[model samples]
Target: TAAPGPQLFLSLCLSRLKFPSDLDELRELAETLKFYKQEHYGYVLLLYCSAYLYKQSFAIPGSSLLNMLAGAIFGPWEGLFLACLLTTSGSTFCFLLSRAFGKQYVVHFFPEKVALLQRKAEENRSSLFFFLLFLRFFPMTPNWFLNITCPVLNIPMPIFFSSVFIGLIPYNFICVRTGSILSEISSLDDIFSWGTLAQLLAIALVALLPGALIKRYGHAHLKVDGLDGDGRDQAGRHRKRR
Candidate 1:
């Protein structure tokens, strides 16, 4: 016979577990889950982390919903911390997976995109970490695309992890904070208002500025191997090196 404790837990989860599709549904689901979390904190935490990592590792969409859910259940600061940690860890898993198995497929299916990203990466190689942070900070940038392509671009794991962890903080904070006030929010649009977008854009610009300066002014001082005068590599004799 099944253990009563495990059986009860599974039954309870099955009865209440659901994914919210809209703002109304999200509010309802959050309320339900928050109550359940109070009674089964450990189980709820495990379930949330598992679902979050799964979505992140697989490049699934809808993380915004999960972020809000975390806030509703865990409150703002805790939720933000959890979201950032999961985002970085899950993105790292995706990056490693892409490196191991998806490289050829990504290159074959998105040849032009891969080529464009490669050029951009090379152009900012001197300040590649800041460039990555800029991409993460920009709300419009597709993070899933970056997660899968970073390995192909030969971006180091440490830089990729740090950029994701730090760069997505503002975005995550917004989602978590909105979640904490779930009862007051009427629409998803409110979470990402024009003001929020402008702030994200401003942060992205700031992140890119360091890279721009490094590329323009620090080149003459940086000693890179296989580079000739004017900072152009021997392989790309005419192209300016980063």
Candidate 2:
């Protein structure tokens, strides 16, 4: 079994919001957010909270909920862009946070999982870019660890960002589309959260598949190199024909 993504998503989602028994509290919280004056701050804070939960096994829950809220709060294009920004911005925060702490921190927060991740990173050091691409594509790999380890491993930010942006496109589109529909649908059925989640996962596979195939088939055709003519060779070190 691939595991039921919906049940997993729902279980993860509900786990985060251990709400009050009273509907009044719910209403109050929702109203406060709706009327909150510092909209951007709240938005960023929401993202920051997501970053805080980075160590949690199932984090898609928070990110997904935030997108729906972003649509409601910011509306359409602005909301869409803001959602994406929050995601990446939160990721940046997690990256730096984890980097500062190092592997010991990862082991503390996520012993079993982070160990697996560290092993994977070591295995993919030879294909650093593709390794990053794979992680960004599926997102099971905690991005927090990636951000922290990248600098430690001397992986350039340019390579990281290129991989992040390209590999994240499908996920971004999924969130954006979900937000757009959420703007129109004010109810659970209309929200289509379950369906949208499934669709997005499927779309993720669909989007990543082509790229994977192309890379697998055409890796030789694509060469990654530094600006120097001899990529691995040090040009500045050359003492011209002495």
Candidate 3:
């Protein structure tokens, strides 16, 4: 029999691969993929990027595993850069896909969430970018939810891309760095411990501060809808007699 071509070799490799569901499985998967990467560097890179983008662009979960795989194959700095770049690119693709085709479905399925986000967006319109950064930095926030609903919230594309790219640096760094020391990890909790959560929460709060200040102090000088001469919202004031 002739030697298998790169495609056939890749197919055989993928057939043995499964998405890791736990620490041991993740370690095994990492080792297997690392060997393949050594043997077929270009094909492995393409495969990894495609998988990452597919999950992100379609809002599928399980990015943590991919980040670790990147670190195992490419080392810390390279993996971090690749993870960050792919994340931004994939998220922007999601944003565009949602804008073009998923809007109606998103609105119909999550009407209340859409309405809530719209109100929040209006409330933070002055410091919208900071508000977005806050959302991205907040660990409890569901990024997939934001990705799908952002278009309906009328968030500008530039702001969306920049926030996703810059605001997620810490998060991506944590994952990729953890991947560098994967052999030492015993559980998922090791990747995001209480201390890590606290740090992320602190960053989120700091990101929110600028938006809070703008909402408090900048409203008076800006032209705001449904606000009166005193800068109090019109809804709070009693109507004048005709």
Candidate 4:
């Protein structure tokens, strides 16, 4: 008998690469998994979770497909829960790894940005939670970059974890639910329609508002204090009305 591990791993990678686009093929794959679901549901879940974690830890690019599979296989609520769990755990692992060993590489690749971002993160440590929420919710912000940068920026662990856990819920909800209706999707673009984009952008904007307002207010207050100082100080006021 031939050892089947390599073949199985290759097939898994190929299937992931061919995801949603090859609906018919995915349907067949799903049916095969369904047989396993019948015989050993626990095994299926373990494989799925491990694969998700592996992809995240390695910076692989097929998580969106896995998100959909979560819904299609486990149903919306279960899929949503699993996706959130895997995303948080996997992202945290990546963050810690980057913190441990990614500084020199990031500095080499993005010399200017690394120092500037580190300074800004240190200056606005108190507001990192909102900034993180905005980044996580905003579609344009890449999760992999955030994962690498969060630790590099020295963002607190609690804020980073909480932002990911909470900020990702809305988008995860959309993705996991989309999985349930994968049969109707003709292309991956359908996963994120304009309306959906608007919703995510709106959430990101809301998350960003407090930080923006605070920054604006601080600047304005500084300007006002500077203008006041130009006129007179407490001792000057006591000396004369001029």
- For lDDT, the strongest prediction is 1
Can you give the lDDT of residue 27 in candidate 1? 83
Where is model 1 poorest over a 10-residue stretch in terms of lDDT? 231-240
Location of the lowest summed lDDT over 10 successive residues in candidate 2: 231-240
Report, for every candidate in turn, its global Cα lDDT versus the true structure.
0.73, 0.50, 0.72, 0.65
User: TM-score of each candidate?
Assistant: 0.73, 0.51, 0.73, 0.66
lDDT of 2 by residue, 15-126 (tens): 6433323434433333333444243344435543454345222223345555555554455466557656656655555555555666465455444444444455565677
RMSD of 2: 14.8
lDDT string, candidate 1, 120-168, tens digits? 7897798888777766654323788789888999999999999989877
**Model 4 regions more than 4 Å off:** 1-26, 183-242
Query: By lDDT, highest first, what's the ranking?
Result: 1, 3, 4, 2
Report the lDDT tens digits of candidate 4 across residue range 146-189.
67777778788888888888877766676676665663345879
RMSD (CA, Å), each prediction: 9.6, 14.8, 10.4, 13.9
List ranges where model 2 is wrong by over 4 Å: 1-61, 107-119, 144-154, 186-242
Q: Look at candidate 2 and tell me the lDDT of residue 92.
A: 58
lDDT over C-alpha atoms for residue 164 of model 2:
60
Tens digit of per-residue lDDT, candidate 3, span 1-242: 33446887678766876666676787787776676666677877887899899989998778877787777678778998999999999999999999999999878866655666677678879888877776676532367778887899999999999999987776677677656667445678875877546645654665566456645544453333322223121211211210
Q: Clash totals for all models, in order?
A: 0, 0, 0, 0
- After superposing all C-alphas onto the true structure, candidate 4 shows an RMSD in angstroms of 13.9
> Candidate 1 at 134: error in angstroms?
1.0
